[model samples]
Target: MLQRKFDEVVKKEFPNAKDAKDTSIHYLGKMQIEHQLDISKVLMATSVCSDDINVPSTTFFNVLFGPFVMGGLGGVPFVGQTGMTAFAHHIPDNGSAFIFYGPHIGITLEGDLGKMYRPRMEETGNSCGALMLALSRLQDNDYTPVINDDDYQQMKLEESLLPYRDEILGSDNQAKAITEATYKIIDKKIHEYIKTCKNEFHVDKVTLLGGVIINTDYGLDDYFDARNFEVIDLKGL
Candidate 1:
């Protein structure tokens, strides 16, 4: 009953979202059937946020090979092209690659958009702590992110969000809006890196599952709103 209430709140923002575990099963089945991929041989890489909460969000973590983590804060593929090259090189012999990438938002039972209870916590805190921080910083009209080595990832995250500042700030739901914008940015970067490092992959097919991860309260199931699923023919690229 409590879980249902939270689902209502999450679905209000992401109507198409499904349980995270179910999503993993669905995609795994699709990869096996439609894409003809071998479940055991496929290597998995993740480009989601660095948040530990997201680690257990889906079964992909348990079922696949090295999650050659490619994302940093806000789910940006911060590891860049070199990382992509490494991930590609690490694919199982004659096996395909699967990349699961996205940004996550926490939805509370009371209908809040960006806060939830983490494991062992009694209070709701920012799920995408990096993203919420970015949103808070973005609220300041004159604040500009300066690129520096000390906080390069956060700076780059805010820098990537600059163009979407107006769109996100002006939205009816800023949390959801920023999350959506971040998804677009992450998706675009993933493709760019893949295209840039396409040759590094010896595999013939690369399956992609990109989306927004909706985090629920601790011990409850999370959800994934899939936005893109494709099996790229690397041979043609």
Candidate 2:
């Protein structure tokens, strides 16, 4: 049933596409060069930790070769670049410093959180990294995001009984509360990053990219307001 629903969503979103593989290939080929360069800058910001630390050589490699890899196989090179950039950007140039990159949320530098949160392709449950999990649990399965199998599912028996308050809540008020709470956590983390890392690193702007920006009904604009951040949609480029 989930597969059928997903297929229907894809068909509705890309009606002229021949199949999934074809859609992926065509979509990958549409990535503009200017957009790739903009993404490279965000990848670069992830590396800014201290004065002594220099940009890693791998950063350059990813920026240059990322498109080629994506052409051969569909994946975002910037996602993996986040970790390497954080490692190079640390103040002491030591291995201890870390950062968190939530695909749907945004980047959270070290010190923003008590500990590092590993990036997961799917949100497992109602934990610190469960924004996607809550969205997955929404009762109206038709309102699904453009995510993969493990992350997007029809609500369970209990989840379907959830009461809706408005469009933002869908038919699952619990899911709405969870999703809003998760965004609050992420918003707080970003402010903390601004307080500690922004000036030290000479950071000025933030950019958000991914399927979540387009697929999800939630808007991240207000969360980033007055923070010098902009959301970019490569598909519209």
Candidate 3:
């Protein structure tokens, strides 16, 4: 019933879109999810790696919470609410609930997406282009027409980036540079969060599930471990 409702919603919103055929994994999880999908909780980690800019909820949720989990995790307040409300229309009141946030987990789902969706590498430079490529591959798919091809070009111009070249993005140094920048952002946010944390909620075992959890460097894993919070690399699963 939930699946049927989701299909109806998706079809209503994107009339031209095709329902991705149900496969082994979907089948396996279908029945359980219809009832109690073991995992009771979920957290979405979106990217704030780049400077603050607006992004659509669908894009963010796909990057943050694709690959169906036990419960609904990533969605915006408005869209997610509507979608989940539609979902709850079928679900029992005793079933699991859902939630969403604005880059609460610092997952960096846009790792390569921001740069890769460009039509011309000449327009945005290779770093951004490569990032898009990385995002596609990370999501196990390629660019579709829905993505804005021109966004990267405009972003490049805003950043005053140099000419486009594949070399800049395909290098170990480039990856490291991106990683470092992301870490700085994460560090600041986490530090701020830790400082403000004065209660049990701060110390509770908070599980992180997003792109940023993939990083073993920056001691993110260690930091969470030390705090006794479970830093789950859900992306790996």
Candidate 4:
């Protein structure tokens, strides 16, 4: 009953979202069948948020080689070009590469777009704490993030969203809006990094899967709204 409510609530914001676990099955099957990627040899890398709550979103962790985590907050690939190059180097011998990139937003059973119940928790909290924090700060038009080693990643995450301030704030759902902007940023950067580090990869092709993760309450399956899925031939690049 609780899970059903969550489904309805999440669908209100993302009508096309599918179960996150189902998403993994669909993509993994596509990689093996249509693309001829060897499932045993494929090394997976995730450019999603560092939130612990997101770990259960997909079965990639159980199936893939390495989710060489590239993202920090709001799905920003904090490791940048160097990380991509390193990730390319980590692929299995003669195996292809799979990179998953996206941002996540939480929705409650009662229909709140940015809040959810964590594991064993009684109250709702920000799933993408980094993003929600950025949203709180972004509310102040005069605010600017200060770069420092201690909070560099968080600051950088906030700085990245500045350009989308108006688009996020002006939306009917600020949290969902910010998450969407984050998806665009993450998608752009992932492609750029892949292009810059193409030569580093010995693999013939790289599969890119980018999407938005819809987080729900604990014990309930999350959802994924796939925005892009493409295989890039390194030889052409």
TM-score of each: 0.98, 0.29, 0.27, 0.97
Deviating ranges (above 4 Å) for candidate 3: 1-40, 43-47, 50-175, 198-203, 209-229, 232-237
Per-residue lDDT tens digits for candidate 1, residues 1-237, read 977887788788889999999999999999999778998999999999999999999999899997899999999999999999999999999899999999999998877888988889877899789999999999999899999999999999999999999999999999999999999999999999889899999989999999999999888999999999999998777
lDDT tens digits, residues 1-237, model 4? 877777788888899899999999999999999988999999999999999988889998899998899998778999999999999999999999999989998888778887888988888999688899999999998899999999999999888899999999999889889899999999999999999998999889999999999998788899999999999999998
TM-score-wise, the better of 1 and 4 is: 1
Q: What is each predicted model's overall lDDT from 0 to 1? A: 0.93, 0.28, 0.28, 0.91
| Cα distance off (Å), candidate 1, residue 190 | 0.5
The candidate that achieves the highest TM-score relative to the unseen native structure: 1
> Which residue pairs come into collision in candidate 1?
none
Candidate that would win on lDDT: 1
Model 4 Cα shift for residue 236 (angstroms): 1.5
Candidate 4: which pairs clash?
A: none
Give the per-residue Cα lDDT of candidate 2 at 12.
47
Superposition error at 101 for model 2 (Å)? 5.4
Question: Cα RMSDs of all predictions?
Answer: 0.8, 16.1, 16.6, 0.9
lDDT of 1 at 116: 85
Model 1 scores a TM of 0.98
lDDT of the structure predicted as candidate 2: 0.28
- Model 3 weakest 10-residue run by lDDT: 219-228
